[model samples]
Target: MPKIKDKAIIIGVDAVLPALLAQGVSPHFITSIDPQKLTYEKIADSADQIKDVSLIAAPYVTPEVHKIFPASNIFWTFSTKSIESWINSMLEGKILTSGASTCAHLNLTAAIMMGCSPIIYIGQDLAFPEYRDHAAGVVLSDPDQIKKELGVTNQNTVWLDGVSGGKVPSTRGFLSMRNHLEHIMASNPGPHYINATEGGAHIAGTEVLPLQEVIDRYCSETIEFPSRLHTALQDSNLSNTKKLLSGLNKALNDTKSLSKTVNKYDKLIHSILHYIRSENNNGAARSVSDLPILLQNKISNAESLEKKMDNRKHLYIWQILGEGTMEDVKKSECSLHEITILAKQPENFMLSFTKNLERLLSLNKARKNILAMFQHRLLHIINFHRKEKIILKKIEQKKNMEQNLFELAQFYFETGNLVLAQPVLEKLLALNPDSAEVLFYSGAIAARQSKFEESEGYFQKAQEADTAMSKRVLEFRRGLGGIYFDLAGIQEDKIYSNLSRKMLFKGIRYCSNHPKIKQEIIYLAESDLTRIKSALESGTINDVETILTVWHKGLEENKNLAPCITDDQIAGFHRHYGELLLKKGDLDGALKSMQAALKFTPDNPDLYATAAELFFAMQDFTNGITHLNKAVELDRSYAILWENMGDHLLQTGEINDAIAAYEQGFIAIPENINLLKKIGDCYLENGQLEAAREAYKIVKEKYELAQPPRT
Candidate 1:
């Protein structure tokens, strides 16, 4: 309030506030986003006791919060002009700065405007720490209560940077708040932000320090703030009042014009719906194209009205009444586009036309309610300024009409409601014929409906629309691969299967870096191997060898692929071939293939173990022991490798070596019951009764713990 140029700590998060308060660091100003936080009560009680400390309230503050704090000690910060005008016309026309959409942001902006420099942030953890949603003393509802009240449980966790520099459990909401704060800080660069919250995700551009350290470094001993704040508020009120009244009159006139425009739209929508329902097939098809021309005047009128109402709405009831039906009005333009497309297709013209009519009717119904609400609020504001008590006419029940086509479609898509999303996507596509975003959504919708051909077309179109392949080529190729894989599985015709195979290969060529795409390619190849072999044998697929060669070449050439193809994957290919050869009684060929696999995955413990087994089968004990030892040495953490080494040593009649190997296995996996038992047997055989008892005791303890406690 005193234009403290040195420092001011803005407190928002409840988690860190109590800790800062305990440290005796009085914040310059305390801000509350939600009046319901437990810290608000604490702050209110301490406001009178703390000298020069001001309480800043956001527009969302309840009446109860106002009563708790003295009026003189409270300085209001308006988040937007609409909020300012609605609360007090005296505070209207003030420069309302946005703070990246949070009350913390509002506090930061207020502090900056109040001339507080080098702001210190406390209790702005912006993350759920230690698996706790909020800090101690912060009010939180139970999961069941939240689910009942909000129709969804608030209990969710995400990974955030903990104090220890590792991921800790947090909530998505906190992460979002943290991201917004970071953006705000980035945008406002002059004032240095010192993060004294101490724990939680680290925010860039804020120096981390203890609250006391920050205070000692920047704060002065004593300062007069309350008197300055009071005077400033009075000056602002007087200046804003005059500007607000002028804006209000303009808003009233704009609302009247918008209301008439909405009425016109309503009449036009009704006319179009009636015409569509009454007309026959040929007439309806023609009307679909002609309807846009008929309603062009009304659409243009609505747009002009909206343009005039643009920034003026922010001066009145825009925030309270919501965005109104402007979104629906804008989407009507898209409906007109769809109608034009429908006109060209006479086969489904009437059905599509009727659907568009129904949408238009829905939009109009919503527009009427929105306009009515706006008119009512404007009248109420005018009456308040005039000091008149007038009974206002109440509108009927508000029917929930879909306002934003894109958002609604997105919601349906995310919720797995493909059927609901498809028509909306079609409308979107009509609106922007070349929009890659709409094409991508359309492709997704088709894929979910299992319309593979349609999905393929949409995905290809999306890829083509984004010719630079800067945004969607990878995703499109992956989608195409999935479609072809599905098509290959379902199609019985050899020619179709071959085409699917070729497309899949092409998709793999384009999206070889995507692990899922690579895996899908491998799956299709292996699953359809027999069919492909038959096709090759019958000379139906002449370029089988060429396709396989190109597939391997693509995998090798992918620059984005970062060693995703492991040595084990190479070994797996050889192993599969070896198994096939073994089934054909080709022992020499099988051995050669297995040896080839070992060459690629020399350090792979499992491959070494498999090679040892193969050697044992060939009665080559020397090579078996060599491979087993290599396996154990390569991965000492693997208990199986140690066990294999122990088994080989025991078979060779090396009792001491066998006991050592078993002990090593037990060390690697102490919970391995089999290894534990083997260690005990070896100890017992060596007559070491104490060691035997120790091993058996561990086994018994582990076995008991693994068993469920009495019921």
Candidate 2:
């Protein structure tokens, strides 16, 4: 049990009330309110377990609730700039306040105001595990199925109405919440923040506690004895039924007492189970298939509304400009109301604003009236349609491209936007009947969909195509080999290993002259060998050793291929090779091979930063600092580089310079241990005992007890 002042303020919502109260934790609760359903009394009543509650926008609390809360306990706030004056006046120095985004942001704001040491979050469930609309009663459904049925891709499923909460909720509110949280955390720096729950999306720099642990903490530590009302009612000798009802009402205030109610419901659960068994069970499954279509209609309607609103906004803009007089508009304040007024009378604004107004007035009465009201609107619609037409034509042209289809398809594929790439491949295959490249990729897609025969057919066609492509024999064989390798990756057939080996052999034979192709072939062969060892106990170790030996020999013989490779790829190869050598008990060999790989990429920041571990293993600090300095010079932007360098400096006994370097590095990258420890050691070396102690204390307070960094 830590002292109350030493502990962090825990920010949470309704789910955490019982748990926090049980721990005697008097944390500041920041309530998020829906303006349309604003009712201060309801929230206050629900959160009765807590001693204090801070309201951001207390939906107009009733007189009773208002009287109960001290004026300082509540604060009025809004994310929109429209209420800036009111917010500033009402919310000054409030310990907790809500923001437009995630509660994390609001919690960070609250932490800053309190000058708390660290902000820890509980019950910070930011997003749902599955696609769900963010309304009270919206049912969850599969978003993938909905996209397929609608024949369109929709990344965002929610359509949050900007009006009062009466509109059907959409993802807009959730995204706005997430965006707001990120912005506040990025902008403000004071108290450290950590999330203590794992059942939500991962937030950086936060520690995650298991959900079961949280649940246990809530159950074991929270105070939930029977309420005062229950005792009075029981002593009155009321009827059994009346006593039961009284107990239920009293239990609402006692968070722990809810378990008794749950226990009492066991009989009811059994009865419901009996009824479910007696009744028909097929109804639920039958209706599940229809959910996608229902979602499609909702999505379509929302899209239509969005288009209509865009049109209205554009037309209104043109209408305001057409009608406004230059002097009248210049004299008037720019506001939505003034623009609306001008929109209804385009001619009045045009008469003063345009030099051609006199000629416009000379036109025929009917034509002039029509042009004044709707000419711009018609032109806007026509222009939009023309743009759509151009896009459609490009799509068609993309489908018709012949020789360059592979490159074009690859461009789309690498972007992680597969919708367009899939169709492009489909079109390219239609034009070229024996295209091994198209067949191989198409087969990969089919494999993902579990169309095994179709994948096999594509691989077979690729093999045939390779044999016939005499002029482009090397390219065709490589493509065919790739298709076979993919087929091996997907198929669970007994012959998959044999097929994979043959494919690798074929690719190596054809790609002997092409270093890039040879590199890919070797990489794929290595990957298959890893799986083969695990799946087949009797598999020959010689088979794997031969592949490794050949790869090493090839690299030693080829220098051009080594320099041309990506840093990540080189790092991956070195890591795997080192691991393999270590498994063979060849530690020195492993160290040498890893060092050689590092020498080839000495300027790689990630490699340099991690070099200390290797040097430390070898009991050498001199080389470590040299490598770290190179790392810092190569990538000054990496947060971990300076931290590693600081450690190396401290190890070598460079007291004064180490302190300066650590301070500079820590300024660049916060929450780094090497810099913190090195700075403290530097202070100790210089006989500044107090400064050393303070540096160590700050590091312990902020980093030692901080949550692990998340993915």
lDDT of each candidate versus the true structure: 0.58, 0.47
Q: Which stretches of candidate 2 lie over 4 Å from their true place?
A: 1-8, 14-27, 38-44, 47-72, 75-83, 86-104, 130-173, 205-711
**What are the per-residue Cα lDDT tens digits for candidate 1 across 573-668?**
555555555656676766776776777777678767666767767878788767766776787665586687677877787767788878767766
RMSD of 1: 25.1
Q: List the residue pairs that clash in candidate 2.
A: 22-222, 101-177, 102-177, 158-170, 158-171, 159-170, 323-349, 324-349
lDDT of each residue in 345-442, candidate 2, tens digit only = 64443222222222222222322243344434434434444544455565567654575566656654444334345677887888887788777666
Residue pairs with clashing backbones, model 1: none
Please give the lDDT score for candidate 1. Answer: 0.58
Query: How does model 2 fare in lDDT?
Result: 0.47
